[model samples]
Every structure is written in C-alpha cells, then in structure tokens.
Target: INCSFQNSVEFSQQVFVHTSGSPSFSSDELEIVEGSILGKHYKVEAFLGEGGFGIVAKCRDTTTNRAVAIKVNKSDPDILQQAHVEIFILEQLRRLDPDAANIVQWNGFFHDGERVCLKFELLDQCLWDYIRDRNKQGLPISEVRPILGQLTNALSHLSSVGIVHADLKPANIMVVNRHESPIKVKLIDFGLACPASAVMPGEFVGTVGYCAPEVMLGLPYNEASDMWSLGLVAVELATGVPLYPSENDYDYLKFIIETQGQPPDHVLDSGVYTEDYFIGD
Candidate 1:
C-alpha cells in the first residue's frame, strides 16, 4: 500500500489488481452488488447508519460467527480511495495497539468491485447515544466518572505515543460494559484521524463541533488538536449537553470559538496551528 499522501483521489482511478501466477485479474474486470448482502463472508444483521462516506451495517461473520460492523465506502472513486487510505491507517494503528479494550479490532478488509469494505468490532452503543439515554434517566455524575476515567486513560496513552485522534467526539467513542471490572471506552473510527506528527495539507478533515481551531484554519496540527476535541467531550460528559450546539458547520465552529476562545499558546507551540480559525459567533 502507498503510505505517502499524494492526491489520493486522482491516483485511485488507476487502481488495479493483478495476480502473478497462472492468471491475472484487474479490479476493473470484477463486479459488485450495491445494497445487497455480501453472502457467505458476512450475514447482514441490520443497517447501522448512513453517512456521506457510505453505509455501515451490523453483520455476523459467517465463518467465525462473530458480530462485526461493516463500513462500505461510496461508489465514487475519490471516496473509495479515501476509505482505502483510512483502512490502511487503521490496520497500522491496530498493529501498534492490539489490546481489545483500547481500540476497535479490524477483522479484515475487502473490495467489492465498486466499493471497499472495512470490518470492525461491533459495539452495542456509541458514547454519545449512551450519554443521551442516561441523561434521560438523569444518571448522576458519580456514575459516569468511572467511564470518563477509562476514556481519559485511553487518551493519555494515545497522546503519549504521539497519536492525535482528530475525531474524539462522543459518537466516535464506543461503550463496552462487558463484565465491568472497569468500564471500557474503545476508541473507534480512524477515518478522520491522522498521525500527530504528520502535517496535513488541508484545513478541513474532522467533525464540526469536535474540530480543533488550528485544523479549521488550514494550518498544521499536532497532539493539542486531540486535546481540544477531548475538552469538548469532557464538557458533554459533565453537562450531558454538547459544549458547542449548532445546527450546521459554520454555526458549530462559531459557537465553539465564542465560548472556548482560540487555541491556547501551548497548543500553537505544537507547530500545527494558526490564529485564523474561529469556533463560533
């Protein structure tokens, strides 16, 4: 896989697969079924959700009978290439951290003619949904502390290793309460995450409310970007409300800036930032 970030969208059109021995086949020669069960490989249980990227479905791995979440990329070449890059990055990160409690396990990846599929461990609920439901019951802060602690530890570990999870919102965090010696907050979805040390050429990449100020300004970014997102998560956990409440991207960013202020000097010192970004009105 090409690790270097070129214009992935342009290069994706040239993607071809070949077999060295006996016979060779090109990706163009293969076919795919849209909105159909993949069959044999995975049994589709239910639809999970849909996003601009593609559809996610809860599936049972037929061979192992294990439940997994399958994310199917859009048919567009650019989207498909972006998904491939995401899967590759996830595979590398999983190799670095194999502990099931820390991150989502990537079962496998495959291409279905028109799209790429990523198989991830399926969790019952996302952190955001869990908090919303718990809030309806008016769960005490004390009850939620333990869950928050575990997540903080995960963030600490990732940050220590120089990995900044660009998208650290409630939805990206998964809640797994199996046999709770300690509640687990498995960090899932690396589709928006990038290496903390790498300099991103673009200004936009992450979710609106969760995006760091530096990221929105089209500047470089580092670990502090993740911290900013974490701060938003902390606010949500503490109040059961989003720190920046806005209906759209522009409004969301405005809300954050007006309240959170600009990124602190310590954040800018990380060398992945600029002052041009604003969070909210």
Candidate 2:
C-alpha cells in the first residue's frame, strides 16, 4: 500500500526532463561551516565546482582528519529535494555492493536547515582535466593506461549491478591519487544516473557529446548505452579529441550514427523502443 505521504513524495519529484536551461548556482547567501556537523566533523575548505544540483567542496574531515569531497545543494527547496533523491538513490547503490571498489565511497550525508551536504572520498583530477593536462604537457600513452583500466573496471562493475551511468563523460570520472601506481577511477556524479530497468526510453539524460544515440533520439536506453559512452571516452583518450561534437541534439545523434553506424540488430531488437529516428550515424 502506498502511504499518502509516500505518494506525495513521488508526486513532488520533478520527473527527469530535458530542458535547455543552463546551470545556475546560488550566490545569494553563503553559510560556510569551518568544521564538522553531526557526529562526523569536516573542515569545509574551498569550492571545487558547482552544478545545477549542488556545489562540491574540498573538505577535511575532523573525525578521521582526512581529505573529503563535499557536495552541498542549493538552499532552494526544489534543489534540496533533488539532492535528497540523489542521496536516496546513491545510498541504495552503495548498499548494493559495499565492496564495489570502482564506486566512489560515500563517507556520510548531512543537512543543515538550509542545505543538504554529501560527503565522499576526495579524489584527484577528473578524466577530462587529466586528459587536457596530459595533452598540454605532451604526456606519453604509458601514463594513461592505469587511468583507462580503472575507469573500465568501474563501468564494468556498475553495469554488473544493473546501473546505467547515463552520464559517462570524462568529467564524471575522477582519478583518485594521480601518483598512485595503479590509479583508481572513482565514478562520480550520479544526479543523471538511473537504474537500468527504471529509466524510460528517450529521456535525453546526459551531456552532449557523451550522450548515447538513443539519448539523442529520445528513446529508451540500457547498459549498452553506457558502453557506447565509455567507448567514446577511450577513443578520445587515444585521439586526444572529442569524436562527436554536434551542433544540436539532432546533429549530435547524426554524428554518432554516421561514425558508429546504427545500433546493432540485437540492440535495436531490445524491444524497449522501435523508432527509426536518424540524425546521421
């Protein structure tokens, strides 16, 4: 039986929609917490990055006195609700495989009256930044193998758990401890992720170039969609350039189709969708 409050919560969630809305960050009020909250303590340090859902910070946890990554959602109620949903989903993912070495570790989650904060393992550069930095310095391919392997392992594990990392761009894959012998690729940013069976076809839920063909066509997607994205990332790392940079969504879909050709017959026969939409590829 669906409780009235549960129904209200479900109704309140804004179903994922593809909007041309650019990302906006809250600049009105800044409440900086110098150290810890609840039982775990963290010294909120510097702003890492901001997104439509929240702002990530490089923080130092006082309890273990270890470096951490903190994502604090905007004060707006709508954004806060979205953060809750993200946390709820992530908590479930973490529970699914506590020892999923590829997945980023969730330290803890907290909320002050105004904002909800999520604490995660502090990692090194994102794949995009790492690639850019490498290109700038003319780094050798030998230095790139560990990063690539780690990411592949992460994606493989996520796929095994029936999770489709809808957004599998370089930006969402971070290299924790760049200097480590076998660098770890911690998959981050789940705001756009969804369970394989839960997401509907044609949701258009991913970044432009990294987005899959089905995403461009606004059709149902699955684990193969993520594999396509990872393949793109691997090619980009090999070539040092984005394979698909389309002008619009349609053009993007076309570009993917042109190069990769249409989805294989088996994929097309998945029965989740049957639209013959074509952009180019």
Candidate 3:
C-alpha cells in the first residue's frame, strides 16, 4: 500500500493480491479518492496534512458552500479510538461554550465505512508554518505578546472545564487572520487532549521539544504541563528557535539540566524512569 497527496488532496493507491478462493479487493484497498463525496455532504477538495493517526483534507460543505476541514482516521483500532475521544471532547467543549473564538469550531462527525471523519471549520495556516515563512527571525514581541495572551486565555478556558490540551504546540495552533493587525489564532488538534482528572500518572503524551519536564520524566502532570509547553512556544516565537532543541529523551533531560539546573532531588526521585538517566542520589 502507498499514499500521496497532490494539490493538497489525499489519495491512496494500493496493490492487492488475489487468491483462488478470496475476493480480489481487500478492505484496506478502499480509500477516499479526491473529489469524492463524504458523509453525503462534504465535497473533498484537497489534502491538507496527515499524521500518525489520520489525514486532514480541505472540503466544501454542499449544504452551506463553506470551506471546512475533514479529518479522516486510518483503519487502525487505536487511531479509531482516538478519533472517538477527540470528537467527544470537541462536542463537550462546544456545549460548554458555543462561541469559543480561541478554539477550532467543530461542525460534527460522520463515519465513512470503517473510517471516522471529523468536520471542522477551516482556518488559515498553523503558527509553525507562519513562523517559518517569517524567515525564522522570530516575531516581534509586540506580536508574540498578543498570541501568548490569546493562548493563555484558551488554556484557562480548558482548565476551567477540567480539560487539558496535552498537545499544545505551534503546529497545533491555527492562525485565523494573519493579515489583520492583531492576528487571531485558534487551538486545533485535540487528539491527545484528555480530561485533567482522567490522565493517569506517568502517561506519555505530547510532542518532543514542546513537552513539559514532568511529562518527559513520566511523572504526574496536569494543566500546568500545557503552561510549560506554552512558555517554550513563546520563546520559539520570539527567537525562532526552540528553547530546548534536544533530539531525544536523554538529551532533552540533559538540555533541561544545563539550562535550568538539576531537578530538585524530590522531582528526580518522583520520576519513574529517573534511574535510567541519573546515577545514585
């Protein structure tokens, strides 16, 4: 099986083998072709992006003629479970605040055979790409301040609702209106998000470089973890470089120690995998 994107549209081409007693086409051979109709409402236009769990596409809503994003999950069971969780969290957030300007707008969800497709309001590029286009010179503090303020407010709102955006990074944040003076932004990609109280201690989550120390150490974490990520993002936006550009777990811990000093004995002791990196106390 192989996959590729053209014109921002996702297409999959598969080669299959046929047996004397079996069907020529297998379930995995099926794919959402470009220009295909989805949910009987969305007209697939272009592929937006893809991740380990799913692919995102730009589509048009036939009912409203509005541009939207459709996230189509792979047929893997774990990915399907995440898709369900994301949909549930978005629905709950919508119920809590119908007009959350700082968060991506979730239209609804539907299933395309075994695949789950989530519908969302299409927004502009992500902050990661936006910052890259700015020649990686880092944005002015004047601009960075506003983006941080809005993100802080969004995080606060999530905390109030007992939700934690486990994955908070530049790429997960969408820029709404880049041409405007005060650029508008919205948080997207809630696949790794979960209820603050539901997350078990030492659960691995979030992306590297942006992941919080507690998370990297496999310790219990909460909304504060997101704050840690936000702080790193702010620095990246201001300097166009990651504060801790470690390549792996050991290096990440080393960078943290070098920049912030060794963790307090208690913090190191609390980490489940501390002994792997640290010598005797």
Candidate 4:
C-alpha cells in the first residue's frame, strides 16, 4: 500500500535529510488546524495526537482522495535532530513488507514548511485508547493472542534488519481497525529505534513500566529488550492493568524481584547501574 506521492505532494524548501541550516519557530507558528494544508497536498481533517516530537494529523490526501496520518516534527533543534534519526531508522525498515512485518506502512517523507512530515497509513486507534475505550476491561485471550503474534512478527522483522525498537508500549502500538474481525495491529513510533550495533550501555530509553530490565539495568541489550516490553504489553492487554505499574526503575525492579525473584548474581553484577540498586557489594 505504499503510494508514491512524489507527483502530488511537493517538498517544501527545507528537507530533514540534508541542509542543517538553523531554523527557528514558536509552537504557535507551526500550529495546524482543520482545513489547513500540509506539503500543499494533505488537507488537515482532524488531529490524531501530539507529542514531544510534534503532532500527528489525520489528513486527507487531496491528490489521492485517501486518508493518511502525517506526523509533523517540531521546529526545536534537538527534536528536529531526533526526527532525522527517526527517518534514518525508518529508511532501513522500508525494505520489509509493512503488512507481513506487522509494522506501520510508511509513505515516505516530505518537508512541510520547515517541519519534517512523515506519512503513514491511517489507523483506527492506538492500543492505549482502545483499552481505555473498553473501560479498562482489557481484551479476550483470543484477541490478545493475535495481537501479540503480529507484534512479535514485527520484532522479528526488525531483528532481521538489525534494528532495536527502543520504545515499545501500548501507546506506540496501533490497532488497524477495532471493528474489524481478527483485529490487526502495527508497531508505530520509531523515534527511539536504532541500529543494534549502535547500542550504548548505560543509556536509558523506553517507557517507564514497559522498559526491559536490561535497559533499566544499563546493560548491553538487543531485541531481547523489546521482547520484554511485549510481554508487559500482553499482560496489560489481558488484565487491563500494567503488570509492573511501577513509577521508577527502583519500584520496577522491586516488583520484578517480588514476583519473579531477583536475577542471578552474574546478571546483576554485569549491569553498569546495578550498584545503584544494591545495598551490599
């Protein structure tokens, strides 16, 4: 479903891939509202959500007469730099079949004024919203099973391509269509994704409760960390409550130790940050 909009959505003067000229703007200046146009092609219909990166707008591709989600990056320097990194990670992911990989279909990128806009297929709702919509009751095992399968399949593809999805959580997972039978989901938000070889120990990433123990421990990690987050997400899907429900790494480790017992001495000793949690050497 990758549509080539090159003939349609023209790129603005600025592009994230090249040209690092300093750009400045206040949040108000980049605000997008209903009826606004992006890249002179996407007609803003409604806002899906917003984040530190910027905003995701549910826009109508006036050229193709189709719906799409356009994530526009903020003009802040650091945020813009991160957006460039995201594009780098996404470019590596482009080789995989979006459907088979169970990942979001990226429709390439374009410069929307000074913002880096990423185009993606329109999705129904995120797992967080979906769970909340069900009154926090969670979903049946039958539903959860398939959803988990798709996510693992996505992780598999990511691994094959040597990418680590540093951030995997309910909010980053989107359901294609809630009303559709045999619900399908795709992993979204790769802003934290990076090459496995580039992993640096002691660098913390991922959502609080969903973060893997290795990541929290400041140990070298890979796809295994993503698997850990997936396990938490699956539990949340089935119970309507976070399995860890911990606010900080300390509480997170405490809960894990309580239920699963502390990690073996060797594992704990290997973590760069392990000393922070230990009372005795």
Candidate 5:
C-alpha cells in the first residue's frame, strides 16, 4: 500500500510477494511491468504515485491513446471493499453532475486478476508541489480566490450529494497546468471519502494539519468538517504555511487552542478522550 514510486521490477516483486498468501491470483498473472497491458485496454506506462493502500500508474488507453491514471489497490479484502465503495461513490457523483468542473473525472474500474484498478483523468501537479515550487510564498489573493472558489463549489456538490471528502488538503487538489491562466484545479484522491450520514462514531479521518476539531475529538461530524478543513487549506494557500503545523495530536490540539481558543464546554464534555488532554477546561 506504500504509494512511493518503485521501479517496475521492484513493484512487480512486491506485488508477487504480497499476493503469495492470497489465492486470488497467480504470480505471472499479477506481474505488472511498465509495459504490461491491463484489462485488455490500458497499457501501464509508468508509476504515477502511490497511497497507503493503492499504487497509481500513468497509463495509455489503446483505443483513445489518452493518458489516464489507474489506481491499483492492494489485494486485500478490506482494501478491495473500500475501492468498490469509492468507485460507487464516484459513479453516483458522475451521474449527479456530469459536468462538475472541479471534480476529478472517474472513467471506470476493472480487475486485473490481482488488484482492482480504477481509471481517472490524468491531472497536472498537486497544489502542494505548486506551492513548494514557489518557495511557499503563497498565492496572491486573486489567484487563491479562483482556486478556493472551484474547491468550494466541488465541496458544495459533494455535500449536496451526501458525500464527505474526508481528506481534503493541498495535496488532494491538482491544478490543470502550472502556466494556465486562472489556474484551473480539480479535486482528486477520494480514498477516504464516505457518506456523510454514515460516518461512524469515533472514526478518525483526514490528514492531521487539515483535520477538523470535531474529528480530532472523535465527536459526531458531518460535511461541516470538510468546510473546516477547507478553511485551513485557505489559510495555507494564503500564507504558504499550515494553519496548524503540529507533529502530533497533542500539539495539533494545542495549536487549535492557541489560534481558535478552547473548545466550548459542551464540546469538551462530549469528547471521547477529553480528559486525555484537557484537565478540567
């Protein structure tokens, strides 16, 4: 599930070794070399990126010759189930808003005997890289406004459809091109997304710096949690620094308290681990 790039030989070796215990695929069938053709259509070109539970590769669609991203999930049952859920949510979103400008375009998914691969439109660099390239000077208000607006619209669309993009940060947002005027962006990476109404109690989600206070406290949350993350993203974009640059949960909570003040009495009372950090108030 490590998303870091590995050469084809290394990746193939890892996949085979990982799949050895599973009876789902043979070693030969699961071997995914750079030039290997998948699903009888797409040809894997190179490693694009990786995630905690998936490996994404840049691919070429034989029929269209268009570049696309194929995310190959680990051959684990729970991971496979999560991939299915992500595809289902994407399909529903596509049905609801086929022309949603800010959302990443999901093509389809197919199993390659060893893993489920989900195809999506290939996008440019992520906002984090973009910000880093600029030495983290942050974007001008005029530039940040458009990016924020698009992201806001995307979030609103997800909210309307009852989806919560549990993970939303600069890395999850991709710009179409670095040199493009207005810097059009698309939201990507839905690995942690889920139904807003179905969020389980005490289930922690999202990246640390961008995660909402309610999520950190294991309190019940909804789409508003995404908004809270978005607010942090906005500040990061404007200042080129994380609003909460903490390394752990305690420091993160301390950062929140220092900037936004202490949680309300009711929030502290309702938190699952309030006493773990807070003594009285």
Candidate 6:
C-alpha cells in the first residue's frame, strides 16, 4: 500500500448514519420481500441488511441473469436527500476503476415506487461477520496485511476526489470471497459519506468507536478523518478488539490518549469542541 498522505501514520480508525440523523421506521416503510421484483427486472432474493438510509437486498437481474444488490431508500425526505448525496459521490468515484480502487461497483439508480433504489454489484460477507465466523479470534498479520492494502487503495482514490467515507470500519468493508487465496475487499456504504468540503461542525457522523478525532472533537472532517478510521480498523483486524470501545466521546478520547498519547497541541486547539475535552493546561 503506497499510502502517501502526510499524516498517514497518525490517522487510522460505523454502523451507518447520515447528517439528518436516524429516524424511526415503521414496518411498512420498506416493503420489499423475497421474490419481490424491483424496477420490473430485478427479483429480490433476500434482505442483506438495514441501516440509517435504507434496506439492502440481494436481487437477481432477470434480464441479464446476474446477481445484484439494491439499496432501497425509505422514501422519507431526509433519506431521499441522503441517497442523492451517495449517488453524487458514487458518480465522482466512476473516474477510478472500481476493481483497482477496491471500491464497490455501483450499477446505477432507479425508483422503486416512490422510494429511491441504488443498484450495485453483489458482494460477499462483511469483515465483521467473517471475524465472528472465526470466533472473533482475529486474522493473522499475513491476512490482515492484504485487507489493509486494499483499503488503503480505496482511500487513496477517495482522497484524489476529496471524498470522506465518514464511516470506515470492519462492518462497512466486504470481502469479495473468503476462499480467495489473497483476500480481496471493497469499501461499502456511502450514506454518511460526503465531500470533504461539505463537512460541518455539530453534525455527527460514523460509529462512535470507529469515528476519528476531528469528528469526535468537533473539528472540520477532511479525507484525513477517513485515514484515522483505517488505522483503527487495521488494529481491529489484527487484534479482534476495538482500541477505543466506548459509547461516550470523552471515554473514547481518554482511551485514545492513553494508547496513542495526547494529541498534538494544535490538534486540540483547533477543535470547536476542545473545551469539552480540556481544562486548564
């Protein structure tokens, strides 16, 4: 991994969320079920997962006889806006080869009734499930290394276009195939992702444990925030444990300071939320 960011070594570290915040969903909101045909040609096979934005389903394209994954948004205003943002980012990503960049391939988008749906190449198990399948013992350095390389490749591409994944962690990373000799992975889920320039203060993003210092400390989030997340993920893959497993920001910051030492003074001083984390020097 030729990760050449200036602070690549320092920055390293979702479920999934958007700026509007998660909303309560009634059962009827997401109406897709197995055998349901979406966009007329894609037949739903199974529900893959659900997150802040919408439900992901494994579907088969009847016309082409190919497996596909569709993320069906909840049709609510905020969800629709989030879908548009993700599609915008995905379009920006088209400049890079999805395979070489180690990013998920987006097929396109369509409307499933009033809801917005995104089509993508179907992928295998997420890293979290893979680790759990192994009884959470974690991967050896040999295995962890390749995954990191792939992820770094993914990040490098995102950086070129000034995109911040916002949520980067094991669950959001998917293995192309577990049996493949040298494992391959792709970055998934962009509901929380945004252009680095769009990042704003007081708008929370990403899972607490995997979130970066700038995000937690109320500073502007840049592409570097995603790198911080990648670092923590590198550790989790090798250790099978999160370095800062805390629901509280203060607790998480404390764990980070204990393990990595206090953040540089300028880092602390720049945070809008710095007062919450610091007292008199």
* Per-prediction TM-score to the true structure, in the order listed: 0.75, 0.78, 0.86, 0.86, 0.85, 0.87
Candidate 4 ranges beyond 4 A from true positions? 1-29
Query: Which predicted model would earn the best TM-score?
Result: 6
TM-score, cand. 1 vs. native: 0.75
Query: Which is better, 4 or 5, measured by lDDT?
Result: 4
lDDT of 4 by residue, 48-143 (tens): 877667788899999889999998997777776677677777878888999999999998888887788999999999999999988999899989
Instruction: Please give the distance, in angstroms, between residue 56's alpha carbon in candidate 3 and its true position after superposition.
Output: 0.7
- Quote the positional error of residue 239 for candidate 5 in Å: 1.6
lDDT of 2 at 20: 25
Candidate 6 RMSD computed on C-alpha atoms after optimal superposition onto the true structure: 7.7
- Across 1-281, the per-residue lDDT of candidate 1 in tens digits comes to 35343333212323421111112222222232333556347767777666666667787777888878888766776666567657655655654563533777777676666677888878767888877887634335665676667667766766655666677888888876633545577888777655565545344667777777666655677877877888778778777887787655657756765766755666545533243343221
Tell me the tens digit of each residue's lDDT in model 2 across 39-68: 246677767777776567888777777878
Point out where model 3 deviates above 4 Å. Answer: 1-30, 98-101
C-alpha local distance difference test of each model: 0.64, 0.67, 0.77, 0.83, 0.77, 0.81
Off by over 4 Å in 6: 1-17, 20-28, 262-269, 277-281
Off by over 4 Å in 1: 1-36, 98-101, 136-139, 178-182, 260-281
Candidate 3: residue 228 lDDT (0-100): 92
